[model samples]
Target: MILSLLGRLGRLWIVPVALAVWELAAREARAVYFPPPSGIALHVYELWFSGPPARLFLTDDAVAHILPSLGRLLLGWSAACLLGVVAGVALGRSARLSQYLSPLIHFARSLPPPVLLPVFLVLVGVGTPLQLAGIVFGVVWPVLINSIDGARYIDRQYLDTAQVFGLSRRERLTRVILPAAAPKIFAGLRLSVALALIMMIISELLGSTEGVGYRLLIAQSQLDILTMWAATLLLGVLGILFNAAFLAVERRVLGWHRAAL
Candidate 1:
């Protein structure tokens, strides 16, 4: 246990060390675009803990910025997960439906979410709705595709047994199909979480008045390198936290799958 703890601690140091080296190199090279780690850390600390001279959001604090972004991410991701799983299950279970929708799904998936930002902006007028829409659009495909594949691959023997027992359609689906497809669905959801974060940032960068991305843009415009770096660091932290939480949930929910693995 001690060795495992030490190994984890050592692994954590790797990124900080690599970052330190990068900062030193950038400083030695005297690149205006590249700031050192210490400078970035200072900026992050101030932005998160202190307020700027002018207060835009309530409390003029870091939590203000982070909460909005997190809220959007949650709302959008939840919508995508619910809709994607339903649609994927439908398509996966029905060959005729899958064939009918194949071209449409493929076409939509081919287009990048950024390409639709202008349309969303025009229709939704650059508020929470637009942000949510963009995130949902961006993340739904991976989840939908994965769910379809997972559901389609359900064991024929299981289905045969369920049918022989004269199970109701809903019972068979809830007890058998969904459980079998859950791991794949969860995998897709995990991937979607990352994508959702990226989409949220991108949308905020484009025209959002608030969020970590928006604050980063403001810092850049004001030439506040430290604050920019701080925002970047916060984003990294958020991603790591989100992934860890997701993995915990997956492990608890899918404990039965451990033996299979």
Candidate 2:
């Protein structure tokens, strides 16, 4: 029991240790660019959470930046999830279709999303639509590919058993295929979520008037390194929180799979 506790505490020690090293280095160097983590934390709090908790801890400026970015992120990510799952399942179940579509899929996925920013700007103009389009295009591929692989490789016995049990097509899909492929699907989802955040920032950085990304860009332009660092930190925290929340959901949904394994 003591050893287990020690191991858990030891794992958490790295964070504080790293922060101590960073603070020492930043103070010693007296570099304007490398603000200490403590200063960044304060900047983040002042910029975003200076308001009362009753008001959601967001000032108007924070709201303007955060909500729009989150909106784009959520819309794009949700669309990708829905489309990827549907398309992946369809292609996975049909080997012939997968073969026929392979080349097109490869071509589409190979196009780096950032490189298409100019085209999207022209196609959709500089607005939420452009940002959203870029995000969907970039983030969908991982989930789609993983879903395809997962569904394609489902054990033959499972499918055969579903058939033997006289399950309907929908029943077989929900009861057998989705559950079997869920682990991989969730894995892809995690990747897609991260990609969604990246694309969101890139899209905002290239164009548009609002969002955390835009704020980050403006801070950099103004040489407010602390604010830039704060935004970067905020982004990192958002990613961590998103992943952790998704993991909790995944554990709940796939509890049976864990038992089976």
Candidate 3:
């Protein structure tokens, strides 16, 4: 077990080596904007991870910034997933509805999410609502497109079999269609996770009293070089953690699909 674990970790050898090189380069250059990784790590520890043990080493700043970002990210992403799946599946199942809405859907999808920020703000004002609106609008497209394609392109054999079995429309969608489309849906979901993270940050940067993005923006404006770097490093770590966790879930959920294939 130890050897296997070591081998798996060994595959990440480049990460530490790269950080080491960055540390040495930053130290040699002594640039104000570019601090060493060591300094950034220390600053991050002090800024957010220096609380008591009971609090899981999370300081006030950490609770204030990290929690809001996490809450918004989760809420927004969940809504987007629900909306995308329902809309996509419905559209895919109905040729007439898709024909009527295709142009509008494509037009909306082509516009950047940030461009709609003003509209979101006008509707929901600032704070959590705006952030969620931005995130959902930005991240829903991938899932929407993939789910539509997946549902639309299902093997005719499966549909015919479901019909022959006297399955209801709801049953066909829930059992046959969804199961067969799992792979493509998962692919879109994984992409949306990253996009949700990004949109969360962007929304918070533009508006919000506290969040991970707020910390980064403040640090940048204040010219607190180490804190800025630390915030950026934190974001990178969060991305990796989110992706890894999602991948694990995906693997488990899709294991049956893989076996069948």
Q: List lDDT for all candidates, in order.
A: 0.88, 0.92, 0.90
* Superposed model 2: Cα runs more than 4 Å off: 1-7
Residue 212 lDDT (model 3): 93
TM-score versus the correct structure, for each prediction: 0.88, 0.93, 0.94
How high is the lDDT of residue 64 in model 3?
92
Top-down lDDT ranking: 2, 3, 1
RMSD, one per candidate, in order: 3.5, 1.8, 1.6
lDDT of 1 at 16: 83
- Top candidate, metric TM-score: 3
The ten-residue window of minimal lDDT in model 3 covers 104-113
Ranking the candidates on TM-score from highest down gives 3, 2, 1
Output the TM-score of candidate 3: 0.94
Residue 230's lDDT in candidate 1:
82
Q: How many pairs collide in each candidate, listed in order?
A: 0, 0, 0
Tens digits of per-residue lDDT for model 1 on 169-247? Answer: 9999999999999999999999998989999998999878898889989988999777777888889988999999999
- Model 3 regions more than 4 Å off: none
Candidate 3 lDDT score relative to the true structure: 0.90
The sequence of per-residue lDDT tens digits that candidate 3 reaches over residues 30-78 is 9888888888889999999999899999999999999989998999999
Clashing pairs in 1: none
Structure candidate 3, residue pairs in collision? none
